[model samples]
Target: MINLAARDILHGWGKFLFTGIGLGLLIGTTLTMAGVFRGMVDDAQVLIDNSGADLWVVQQGTLGPYAEPSSIRDDVWRGIAGLPGVAETGNAAYLTIQMAHAGRESRVMIVGMDVDRPGRPGAPGYLTAGRPILHGHYEAIADERTGLQLGERVRLRRHEYTVVGLTRRMVSSSGDPMIFVSLKDAQEIQFLKDNDALVNERARTAANPAFNRPGVPGLLEAAQASSGQSRNVNAVLVRLEPGANPDAVAGEIQRWKRLTAYTREQMEDILVAKLIATSAKQIGMFLIILAVVTAAIIAFIIYTMTMAKLREIAVLKLIGAQNRTIAMMILQQALSLGLLGFLVGRASAGLWGPAFPKYVLLLPGDAIGGFMVVMVISALASVVAIRAALAIDPAEAIGG
Candidate 1:
């Protein structure tokens, strides 16, 4: 018996190949969408893991630094430091801002970390080039993705910082490159005001009767000085003693210190479930829609291919070709198309994943999962065309 599937593909290979390529591009996009979600989750986990913190202490009842704006006094870590099971504590300030570098503006997460220790909670896990920040003021460490070279100066607010170190995979949950600066500088940048604004504020305060009373000699100057300084940090990163439970330590901080404490698990939940939840759901919806579209396209192609072989199909039926044979022919064609599409998709996603601005982590397991999904969808979609072909009677072959 002739190989009907092979014959059909060979006879109309152009249409079949082009249709497969189109479907492949769609499938590629679908796979990329899934990869985008995976990349987001990976980035969140990496952000948490790289922090090397057992717990995060934020302002009371608020998600800090990532999900929302959280400000706690820089000294709050002192209280948390004295808590039991706390191995070490660090004050980390995270502020997302647009900074100008080489005449282009890029949004970066400015992470303020203590430079005295190399293994501090918020320090970079590893460096791609150069070393960690050693000096306190005017020095910076940037992720490689920022495209800033060592010794490059980037201006943040009114201050400029020299890029002293470089790191890899150091990113915010949104995949923005993280730039490390000293806590003091971060605080200043966070609250830095323009000279005109400062002058106007001083004038306004000096005019206030309560602050400008004759008995208050230096009250106005003192007030202005205090206003010029920032003593706040976004969140405190805490490391628990080995063998100590993070949840328990977090509870002590919350109860005694009157601050919100989150364990590693809790922080992950907040980042994934709350921070990027809507985006994940949106991608999921797009994946579903794309899958449906891919299936429809495959079904249409297979149906059209089968229809072109109407005379052959009718003759095969007339010559005692079993219904199973016809069905298998359609099924195999569908599967082949799906296989072709998947190959093209995987290649396309691989080629384009790195070009994306955000992290597009394409894992082997995810690729395997995508392949299975494509096969299943192709099989299901073939049902429509299979039914249509099976319904055609062999008598149609002999019709006028």
Candidate 2:
């Protein structure tokens, strides 16, 4: 017996090929969605890796920077540095804002670091181009995604910043490009109030009899001066001494300083499990919907193909073809379509992955799993077509 499925496919290759391409495009979109979720998880991991800190210290009773608002005095790091098992500590502030560069605005995560020294907890591990911040103020190192070039000027509130260095892959957990600036600048930008708010606050303070008390020399002036400066930071990043236990160091800080300390593992859990939990759920729902739609499409295509071959199937039955032969032919055709579509989908995903704004990490394991799912869906979808083919009566071929 001739191989009927191959002959049928070759005879109607034009329409079959077009249908396969359309299905492949849908599969490609599904694969890309999976990559997007993987990319989000990877971005969180990268943010953790690049911080180069073993512990994070934040305001007491708070989840810390990414999960919620956390504010502690910048000077807390000084006390933390002297704690046992602590080798080095840095005051870091994190705030996300839309920044303008060369007429385009992009969202960026501003990181305040102690550029005064190398190998500090929050400093970028390395620079791809130019040099790290050399000035005590008004200089920055930006992630390349910000479209900033060395010496380019970027404005933050009333001050202007010059991009001094560019770093690669230093992004926030949400994939926002990071701009690393001096601790002072970040404090001023994030903590300081605007001029209008400041004037009102000063006026309010002066009117209060508490700060403007009679016989209290210089009381009003001191109160006004303190309100103008920013002394708070989002968190303190800590690097432990070699062989130092992270939990032990964290415990020491929590015990004496009355602040919250998180080990690297704890912070990672907050970022991936809590901070992005909603986003992960939304992506997972999309994956399920896409999978169901793909199965439906395969069933429709295979059933339609079987219906169109009813006359030929009747002729085969009249010539003594077994039911098993007919069912296998349909199953083979369905699997062939699935294989063709998967190869196209994989190629399409690879081609368009980099063009996405956020990272798109296509892991090999996901592809393998997807292929297995596709084959299973194909086999299941062929059942409908096989049932229709097996029901055709041989007498239909010899009807009057």
Q: What do the candidate models score in CA lDDT, each in turn? A: 0.89, 0.91
> What does the lDDT read for residue 99 in candidate 1?
75
Instruction: Summarize candidate 1's per-residue lDDT along 1-400 as a digit string, tens digits.
Output: 7777777788879988888888888988998999899999999999999998999999998988789888999988888888889999999999889977778888999999877777888988888888778888999999988889988988888888999889999999999999999999888888878899999999998898888889869988898898877899989999999999888898889899888999989999999999999999999999999988998888888888788777888888988899989988999899999999999999999899899888898889989999999999889988988888888889988997
For candidate 2, lDDT tens digit of each residue in 1-400? Answer: 7887888889999988988888888888889999999999999989989999999999999998777899999889999989888989888899999998778888999999987788899999889999988888999999999999988989977788999999999999999999999999998888788889999999999999999999999999999989889788889999998999999888888999999999989998999998888999999999999999999999999999999999999999999999988998999889988887888888899999889988999999999999999889989999999999999999999998
Per-residue error (Å), model 1, residue 160: 1.7
Q: In the order shown, what is each candidate's alpha-carbon RMSD?
A: 1.2, 1.5
Model 1 is weakest, by summed lDDT over 10 consecutive residues, at 1-10
Q: Which ranges in model 2 have alpha carbons more than 4 Å from their true place?
A: none
- Candidate 2 backbone clash number: 0
How many clashing residue pairs appear in each of the predictions shown? 0, 0
Q: Candidate 2 — worst ten consecutive residues by lDDT sum?
A: 98-107
